[model samples]
Target: MKQQTKQEILYRFPDGFWWGSATSATQIEGAANEGGKGPNIWDYWYEKEPNRFFNGVGPSVTSDFYHRYKEDIALMKEIGHNSFRLSISWSRLIPGGIGDVNPTAVQFYNNVINELLENEIEPFVTLFHFDMPLAMQELGGWESRDVVDAYARYAKICFELFGDRVKKWFTHNEPIVPVEGGYLYDFHYPNIIDFQRAVQVAYHTIIAHAKAVQVFKQMNIPDGKIGIILNLTPSYPRSSHPADVKAAHIADLFFNRSFLDPAVKGEYPQDLVDLLREYGYLPVTKEGDQKLIKENTVDILGINYYQPRRVKTKEHLPNPEAPFMPDRFFDYYAMPGRKMNPHRGWEIYEKGIYDILMNVKENYGNIECFISENGMGVEGEERFRDEDGMIHDDYRIEFIREHLKWVHKAIQEGANVKGYHVWTFMDNWSWTNAYKNRYGLVAVDLENNRKRTIKKSGYWFKTLVENNGF
Candidate 1:
């Protein structure tokens, strides 16, 4: 007689857990010029400085999601996707960002939403994903209060149009990226290194977010949830020394708490406020902005964790004549022997996901949340393709598995993490970097007339979703 074998125990998730992927309009949607769409900052920037983008590739013809939504929706269902996050192009919806709605854009979005619902996949809609309408940008962008009001109008229009079918609405995605990219670091359009402008931009983004949330509440779509997606990088110190810890705390205040506090707690961190006050970097505010923000905090939080920020005390004092910047308070400390994702140069610290969720649980009233964006981007992914036209991406499987293990641990520890969505569903155009790094479960063959092929990891992910765990 054969010996009896033990059944393997599996890590299981709660019933009805969300399993899907996220994408942005500007990154995925091609046909940038068609459908009566107006130029956003990206289109304008790419036209002016073609070389600024990777390999001179612009946003005009990306993944061609515009012409192939039906096909893409079918592929989404082919995988184990129960939910998908996509953004409405403000430029496409309201060409000038503050005028009449484009009927063409309206019809396009409705069809996509209906398709997702028909396939049993929930649609998560985001209002803005760093694609500012060129007209709005011309009006001084976020520096001018008029643009904030414009954003509020745009958000309201979106709610009224799609709020009936789309239940999950997000005000902004990684609102800080614009401040750092466009203002502080000169990586985005209208690049400038003005810290004052960066502060103003950051402050206004929160206000705009709150205004959208307020509009969402007023509309009161049944089962609707409004929130913001923030890329929260846990700040870690080189050592537990007082100076190192203090430096890390300040780094957190600048990067994490700057947006997290106002969105969740309805107030800015006192230390952050005091530091800004000391430096006279406070943004211009109107009389009732505080009241508006305090009364309109988010209903849920979308935490996008990629890596941890390791900081140490500044090695040397800043030059008095130098422009103001966040690094004035702390210096980056790269830990030796740390694992890294060489393709993206991002540290692969899987436990950071658990740390972020635990922090939200302990400090942020245990509000409902989810892993909105987490994945690895590898360069030259074509080199890994096999004879069967499939890309055997085992590394992506390992990366996601490590992250999910920590997510499961967080759930066990009482963190109210509701779902986990990878960074993207298909290989799409990344801003500036274009397609230098691919972070998709499905590969797009640019040489093969933009054909779509699900990678090995996509099959693995489908099984993972079926099991709800590894």
Candidate 2:
């Protein structure tokens, strides 16, 4: 039997299942230098090397959200967004990432939050989203205990200021990206290829996350929930061979469990610890750090699933002379006949979503969770626009439908999944890629005075939210 009827009820999400999208401060809110905002790494990096970003376009004026948030929030209500997730820029909230809070930044965030509440959209706030203040970077970024302490203080300040209204909080989004990009791959600012430093950066990030959770608990905000947002990429083996399975397991340890285990289970995986210790790469830790992490496990989790990773046994031994990398233990396997997002160079395997939810259910205590981010980014989206000025993005609609089907299956099988939030509500600046790809339901016209038009997918989304299913 196909079991189709048994699973159909799961497709309709429970009432108050948090229908919305996710966005970050740097990605959407322009006015980078205005409104008394201090420079984050993105602002500083773009100034240092304009050529590094695609088409030399930076984040100084992304979608002008600072000026247009009211309009955006209204559009969000129109699209049936009962909830939304956005991040606070550390540099903007507290200039230099420490000490006195910026009054102007406070007013801006207050306005945004108030507007969302007025529109009946519950605000979900994140404390960090990869936009480290340049001042903090100079003070050793996440590698130093000082910065971690500063982050804790900042989190406390945020709670005291906004905790009364904003109940759902997240400490960090995709925390591993900085460890991989800035310290390992040289994709982010302060690009330095050093494994030991990367390990320390990753460790301190966990510490910072724990500290934030600790402070959030102390505040005792009624009905408040604190969590971390991790981009979990399921690791699959190329074959059933033992070696391939082992290789995939190691990849999972490094990429997924390194953060997931700590945030959810309150401890690091033993195999990950053993591997790091074997390589003399274990991060430096302080007394009580273990207790801190163990005691501050998150109240919820946010899973950002965009793709999966397929790996196999290494074909060749890594050069001992070369610096360490995760691939030293496994090699990427380009699965033949798999679907691909050619625009973003990512494989599209919808089953990965179900696999992730099931793992969380079986391994992570079935923690309350949601699909925090899942969307398709496409190049040349404007080419699909019709005579009515609406983008006919049927491909994106199908992409979302396929992914949601897997989510429905996961829920039917008893995953404690709560809701789904797309990557964004509108097209905005994406780090170094500039505007090369559009991942929004609402098209942003960068050339036509930054006009906004509802895409075909946007209307379809409103219907999905209204019906609570396709």
Candidate 1's clash total is 0
Local distance difference test, each candidate: 0.92, 0.93
TM-score of 2: 0.98
lDDT of 1 by residue, 307-364 (tens): 9999999999999998899999899999999999999998999999999999999999
Model 1 pairs in collision: none
The CA root-mean-square deviation of candidate 2, after full C-alpha superposition on the true structure, stands at 3.0
For model 2, residues 1-470, the per-residue Cα lDDT tens digits are 02234335446777678889999999999999998899999999999999999999998998899999998999999888999999999999998888789999999999999999999999999999999999999999999999999999999999998998999999999999999999998999899999999999999999999999999998899999999999999999999999999999999998999999999999999999999999899999999999999999999999999999999999999999998998899999999999999999999999999999999999999999999999999999989999989999998889888999999888888998889999889998999898999999899999998898988888888878877886
Model 1 segments beyond 4 Å from truth? Answer: 1-9
